[model samples]
Target: MGLFGPSEQEIETAVNAALDKRASIENPSVPLSSQNVLSFLGLDATSSAGERVTIESALGVPAIWAAVNFLSGTLASLPLHLYKRGKSGRERDTSALGVILHDAANDETSSFAWRKYIFDQVFTGGRGVTFIERSAGKKVINLWPLNPDCLTIKRIDGRKVYQYKDGKRTVTYEASEVIDIPFMLKRDMLSHYSPILSNREAIGLAQAVTKYGAKFFEGGGVPPFAIEGPFQSPGGMQRAADDMDTAVRKASKEKRLALSLPAGHKIHQLGVDPEKSQLVELQRFIIEQVARIYSLPPIFLQDLTRGTYSNTEQQDLHLVKHTLRRWLTQFEQELNLKLFGRASARQYVEANVDGLLRGDFKTRMEGYARAIQTAQMTPDEARDMENRPAKGGEADMLHIQGATVPLGSQPIRGIGDNGGPPLNDEGNNSNAA
Candidate 1:
């Protein structure tokens, strides 16, 4: 200790401790080192059901797999278009960047495949990152996907950057050079919360239920049981138990209806049966929980227990509005920001969700008819939407229904030349046509 107070080293240590505490308070996420240790010890996010729910294990649950696949595939199947603001209005952009976004992301990856992969990563790993390759003239040429597992994000000089570890070297990219979409961003903004990880307990329970059902059926629909026998020693009791187990398994395998045990031995069921435990109901409930995690209806996960004709139709609209719309908007904005830059207001990217209605031909046709009749869309535009050839001439011109006309322009049949009905002596129509 110093003469009047603590030593310089002690003061420094106290200051460091305070700073560390404040940092922990501000950023509550686990440190990378601690996460590594937890992972190494196989203790990361173990659930009450004793299942370790990682991304792979969570996906092993059929409901979770279906949710991720359905969402990613649906979003990827939508048509993405690039547009440019012009004097007339917004027009489709036919530039190389447009082709890259709408058709192919690179020479080897189609746009749909790339988008699916990106969203798969987002749903599974919490983040999707893609690097933009630019030519000498600063024109974007190709887009390459980066593995989120090997990437680290940090804020340097007030701007976020990505450092990706390649096979042997580390490459750093500016924020503008990469497109990043996170399922959910944390308060720190440097890390993201993975859907699989955030709800590990629920997913783990689902996995546990699936495993339990599989084991139950594997034993020929028999619940686990115990053996009670009149044995003289431990070895004799063990042998008797083993014999009983072999006999039961053999009987099940050979499709025999009966299993014979020794006169002195008896079998006792150890646990409740599947039906008593409500395993089927539990499994269906788990599916609903997973659907909730993805903001999807249970019907989408193939759970029709509560589905009705009216509610199922409403669920379709709910999927598009609540679930798909959020993801589509996020993806579109991310692409526009990364591909066009913040200052470039003229160019943007969009996803055409109208393709979702193509499967319902009646609904699509009705929508097109309304749009054309109201002059919101030309007949040729509606035909093009359906991939049909235009009729040319009048088909390209906007046309409204004949019954819709300017107000106060209808002619009065009985009016005089002065635009009033000729006054009879008693104020009746004169019939002066």
Candidate 2:
């Protein structure tokens, strides 16, 4: 031991001992692993609704599929651009890194595909991870996605590291080398809460309702019924019941409107119909639940039960403001941090959500006109946003409405004929006064 402090060997031993102690405390017997093999296999504990709500099962629900697919596709379709901060202002970075973000992450995968895949994992598996492959000079070469199921995250020496199991070999990556986005993080910070797992009851109920409806319809929309007959022996009663079932099925198959039954046998409907069970209403409610889980408005999930012209428009705004903005910001920050590092003050990534308004021609035109008249953006800039070629010259200069002058800076008199004098409201020269 040194006089000033503990020896380096002692510190190493202490750190190792602390890690071991933490492991033992966290998992006394077997080590608690984050491997998602069971989840990948669509195996999870049965939900309250008596349905297995694994990621796959939850996705089998139409509402969940719509929610996840809509969000992932919408985010992926947005244009991501890399920008560099300069003395003048921020300008779009047109370097290879920018291309990697805007166009393609690698030679084989497009930016859209990569982003969609990442968010798909986030929504379903609860975490999305991508590795930034860098060249020897620290230049980004390719962005590769890592399967969240096979990846485990740990904090080692006060730094987060990722361990990805690739077949028989395990590869380790530093936090800086990975872009990690979680649907929701747990208290441990290493693990995440899956949407399907957290809200399994709602999703499971949806699945159950769908399955029940399907089975009901598959039986030719026939409700379960009890056949009451005058039978003396139990064997005769069983045979009668089987004959009734077979007759009902044959009648359904032949599209017969009426069925001939045994004498003195009455068919009593035993279960409530789908309408009485409120299956449609229940399915709609489940859709709303899913929308809530993803922070989406019901309109986005194609639920028009309460949609109106004005409210639907408001929901569109809400989707962008409340839903897409959060995800876009999270993804952008993650990309900027992993690709450029925290110390990189000049360059960062951004997703241009203005593309969402592309279909709103009138809105886009009016917004561009307002921006131009307010001197907020030049004509060329607006054109560039629309992917149109710049007209250059005066079009590149910021323009404002000629009548938009300072409050107290109005001219004393308006120019008259030949620019000689001013005209008044009475069509006379104001100089006469």
Candidate 3:
């Protein structure tokens, strides 16, 4: 009654009465579509637009319990993970990890942020907040809370307002029905945001791995910065190294290979136990797969698996696509944005030779081998080909001169001029010598 103008008990009575009335109207003994059943309760079609409301309502008690448990358990676990990831600094006053944990006791937004750290990547618009508004021709789902539970659908027409010929306009606004279900909410919210987050994460991870490979192993730079004295403390460094070696060997032997450069260099690599590496890789893989699901620009995956056990490539890609798609359906119908379009975009690009040049060197080599075989050229014949000469002579032979634009004037082009073409379309004739 405070905000809704009825006591909780009164609302419950009304809701129950509406449900009974609806059941009788439809068919008391038959199973009905949840929407049809909900409609009998006076929660009509307009309220159910862009939503799967009835299912949540049917599972109301379970949904609430699930939310409560999530809020209590998973939400509580993030700080520990963050701390382990070094969100808190090393060398704190105590060895106890929980001492530095950040707690958001009373803040819902902060709690939401923690939820985002977990599920937002897998959902639409990072936990969708939307509302339905009717214009003349279509429904406008206005952006609202990033996470919305109570949405009011309003209907109005241009006729309700003055046509520049009437005085005061009559507007019809109502809270038609409630869409307070968890799964539908989760679905709608996850769809728009998950693909974006997943795809972005995947692409970013790929880029990072690509860069890591290029910078450290391929380019001969220092390996990642490690904790300084952990290796020197009595038997500590040796144990860590041995553990890393053991982990690598097991991964190699079990065919559980993770990302690595040639000659046993790791990309986004950590030399820890297989379990720890898996955890780290899982974190990285999840991030990358989500990014790829969202359609980020082309990210090159270097064959860091280079001559080892089973390829982690397929496993990694499979997880990414599966997770991304699971969350993609949630926001797609509501937002109408296709998050899985990037693979198609990539396929379109691969139809040309440009794809080969931009592809991994192994692909290029295979292509070259295929070309050589198809041409039936002997190694000696292929080796005898000469480099083609350029049609235009070298610039050094032409005595070409270059210049810069004056401070206040636009640049000009053509013989003797340093600047680009003059402003006039008359072909640089406007410039005074």
Question: Would you give me the overall lDDT of model 1?
Answer: 0.83
Local accuracy of candidate 3 as per-residue lDDT tens digits, 20-110: 7658956565443444544455434232113232222312322222322332233224322111223443322222212212333122334
Sequence-dependent TM-score of model 1: 0.84
Tell me the deviation in Å of residue 221 in model 2: 0.9
Q: Estimate each model's TM-score.
A: 0.84, 0.84, 0.20
Model 2 global lDDT (CA atoms, 0 to 1): 0.83
Q: Can you rank all candidates by TM-score, best first?
A: 1, 2, 3
TM-score of 3: 0.20
**What residue runs in model 1 are displaced by over 4 Å at the alpha carbon?**
1-36, 39-43, 403-433
State in Å the error of residue 111, model 1.
0.6
Alpha-carbon RMSD to native, per candidate: 9.4, 9.0, 25.8
